[model samples]
Target chain A: MEQPEVAVAAGDTSDPLTGLRAVSSLRVLVESYELRQVEAALRAGMSWQEIADALGVTRQAVHKKYARRIDPTIAVPRRNRT
Target chain B: MSRLTDAVVLSQQIVVTATEEAYRVGHAELELDDLLVALTAVGGPAGDVLRSLGVTVDRARSAVAQVHADRLARAGVPAPPAQPRTLPRTGGGLPWSPRADRVLTAGQWDLRLVDDRRILRDLVREPSGFVAEVLAVLGLDAEGVLTALDAWVPTATAPSGALFSPDPRPWRTVTRRGWVPAAPAEVWSLVTDPARRTAWDPWYSAVEERADGVLAATLVGEAEGAKPVPPGFERQEVVPVAREEGRLVEWELRRPDRPGGAPVQRLAVALTPSGGGTRVDLTVRWLGVGGWRAVVGLLLRPVARLAWGQMLLAKHAGIARALR
Candidate 1:
């Protein structure tokens, strides 16, 4: 299994899709980083409402997304399909 | 090596409590919902996320109850009288369902830190499980939960306890250091000056010198909407109990609520020269509070430490400004 090519060369601006691809990849990285920070904040004993307040979202939205995912008793089984 | 393990085990106490909570909810077997409630109760990354999603302990309990009610209605059976959940001692000390046990065990494998968040991350990936049922109750499905979990990257920094502890204590303690780009003498001068100290001390609103050479200070509690301070916190007095010229200063911070019998906190600040600047070391220790208040104080120690750290950082910034 080969890793997908993501790195954009410094001077390679010839390919129109290259910039878009790089931007898309960067967006994923940023989202991952933000999620990681929220996890860190949670580990640091931050509350969901507190985290939501920081992220400018409703508490329910945050909980709905993360409540089960961050639970210690349940392991989300990996699936092949979305 | 044992000490490290002990620290990790001590931190993992929340898991045990979560397990207990699962049992209390009348669940014959510990499920993911119970675990989620436990995490929310213990307060960590998972708890925070749950709160953000509007899943509080009360809300989770109600949701579980509602699910039970719906099931009973569907079956046309009347609800039985609620009974206390007995800690299941059948499986050694753990009462968790077999699958839950396996997941928890896997979380701790390979020396990985098994926390509520870590366990939940693994559980969310499973399409069909008890967690899925709990998700459905919350108006969420397994697929949606998994998608969100997939997007999340677990990158929480090591526990703040791990930051300063070569050997972590059973209790929480915070140690912080700050460097100011100013001479030790200059920094110390400002630090020792009672008037300037109040300006940067996050907890102190005012500092006045008494006729007996003891400095009496009014201490502020945490900022509004932050962690709630103990009642009568504002009445506390921060009196300088010990001092060493341009080197160290110690204060006996007495809580106002306790008055004559209040616990005294010894806060020591040390200044040392480093690379044409000064490094400040602050140590805060709570003393002589026994019984229940001792437990409360222990819990509040971290909050107190945070306040002190913020004060010192501000003080350092002031010093930087003054020197310029």
Candidate 2:
């Protein structure tokens, strides 16, 4: 069977359709990668604030998103804590 | 109720019990060992078979623990003393391991629902893995269990269409909803247009509309993290069942080569305008299958659901990124 021609070339953001599709795929990849990193950081005893800083997000935002998913006891105390 | 419906209800109970067992053990995912313990607890022909073979809930639980300890010892890690802890259940049930998912769906399709006996048979049939390890810890082997199961029979006849009736619903539906950061029109176009599919949809490498208004597509391989098309089912014929321009689109995914075969999947997408974005509701319905192939297909249902959910999430993110 002949290969069908793609409407737009790979990584070609000139077309709105292709551009939007690329964004979605990239987002999925980013989210999966982020999850792995967060899990590793938690296992390494990183604090929520530290992980939030690494991701350039607010501590509350990161904590709210992941605190429930991971074991609470595994996370270390915030760096500011005594 | 029909035997299939009875099996379905029992299977669900087994899954719930298995999830609780996994949670109690501090395991993040439901494994085959947990299912074995669950089967013993959920009384039925499978439980009866196991009980007759001296496999009780308590015995299975201890065997599972011993297997875990043995594995840890083999890895040169000291096994922690058993500690009982009560943890709050997570919102959704624990995710099932791929192997466990396969075992749960290993029943013969002719039997309809994956009955308990089939699950037990599959568990014992495992040559290695958690189930096998646990069985070995219990001083039992696959052949011994298989022999026992073959010889076992129900003491009472299963109640037939007397009081309860077979469930009318045949297909299992999985629905996922996401907010895409794009206008309803844009999201609709992305979903309905075959030309733009490969861009956002990871499942297809190429999709072209046929003259008959059906879709013929080349599926991407599993390397791309997309669900693999079953062997000899490489060719797909997607016929649109219903559509509302810029709102909803429904299609029946079938295999053109398998003439007269029931549609394998039904997909429906509804796009609703929600504050500055589009709310995308994707529904995937798996049609029933019979014979041995159904085992493979049914087993992959959980994996397929996860894959579809992830794909939708990615598509939503991409649309948002592009629009932003």
Candidate 3:
């Protein structure tokens, strides 16, 4: 797979207008509350490793799924909450 | 260095496992079933997304893999990497046609190798700027196509416009819910009356009237708490649908917000008196094509679907509560 600069965004950011465009569709909407819950978990300081375990995935998998989302400035504590 | 890494090489592609329909409720992937589902979801955009990305795809993905074996092998991926492989065939049982075979050779779209686990493509339709243009970037290994994710894009037409043209983008999906035990007009009385409509609906604010019909004035409620009601998810033109009065009672939605948001509905509800009760036949008239429409459609569809289920169940319950 070729590397695309703007292309790097698909897996992460979707155009704000992309969601704005969906407003016209009947059954479709932007992301759901369930997904927001996923984001909320991240904000609550839950590690992707722990989240993966709860979601039945490997730590690497969870981190891969959400690592891009982690704001580096937040200084997430790596220590396991358990 | 293109900020690209040797580690970014398409390590291997794995065949996606088939799962239940509910499994794919949130995400879009590129498996045979998923691709088929996507083709159905995006309708036109499925092909357009591929063509826009310059990736050659078809209703038959197996053959698509064979023709792209050189590229797949270069990335160290197999056709399916797993079971249930359906190879592609030509008119004479060949792999692919001569012209059909040329989609990948310097096509209009660019497929940039992202990493061992991703493949990115530039798909242009509505041109969502840098954020929305990139489609899936999957990884390939000894297996075939890894997890190919559909853009899960918003479906409203125009960069921004009303969804009133086409069928509801994502929400307001009208399925043929069977009729209940009541007359169409009788049920219409329960559903159409503004006060009564409010009685039965949690989302509908109230019912108003224009020259053509009565409007349900209510905020389309989200599931518990959903963000920005899904596309085509908003409500208006909501009424106890009746093509022929007293015979069928149903409901329809019009976006009036997004381009292509107008619904081409084909559902009619009927009430047949039976055993002292009414039996209703709720049928779908038609649904607009999915695709760019559905990207936004899914968001709205959830609430539309959920609200329908809730409205009906609640409507019945509310009516029952009122009757008692």
| TM-score for chain A, candidates 1 onward in order | 0.59, 0.66, 0.41
Candidate 3: regions farther than 4 A off = A1-82, B1-185, B214-216, B222-235, B239-242, B262-267, B284-286, B290-324
Question: A1-82 in candidate 1: lDDT tens per residue?
Answer: 1122212232246754444434433332344345556656777778778989998999877766555333232222331111
lDDT of 2 by residue, B1-324 (tens): 356655655666577667766655655567777788877765556776777778777788888777655553333334354453343312236677777888876654656434577788888776444576677887888778778777876564221111111225686766555444356888877878888766655456789998999889777655443457787577777788777777777888887777767546777777776534565666677666788868887888778766765555444433432332
lDDT for B267 (candidate 2): 71
After superposition, candidate 2 runs with Cα above 4 Å error = A1-82, B87-91, B107-114, B157-324
Residue A16 local lDDT, model 3: 43
Model 1 residue runs over 4 Å out of place are A1-82, B1-13, B26-31, B80-94, B111-115, B125-128, B153-324
| Best of the two (1, 2) by TM-score | 2
**Order of models, best TM-score first:** 2, 1, 3
Writing each residue's lDDT as its tens digit, candidate 3 over B1-324 gives: 121322211111011111111122222112222223222212132333333333432322343223233333333323232222121110001122122123212232333533212222221121332212112222221112212334434231211111122343443433322213233456657654555666645455445665667463545443322235665546566544444445544556554555575655533445554322333333344354666976776667656655454344333433322221
Instruction: Give a tens-digit lDDT track for model 1, residues B210-256.
Output: 77755677654443212456666666566776666777777767675
At residue B61, candidate 3 shows an lDDT of 36
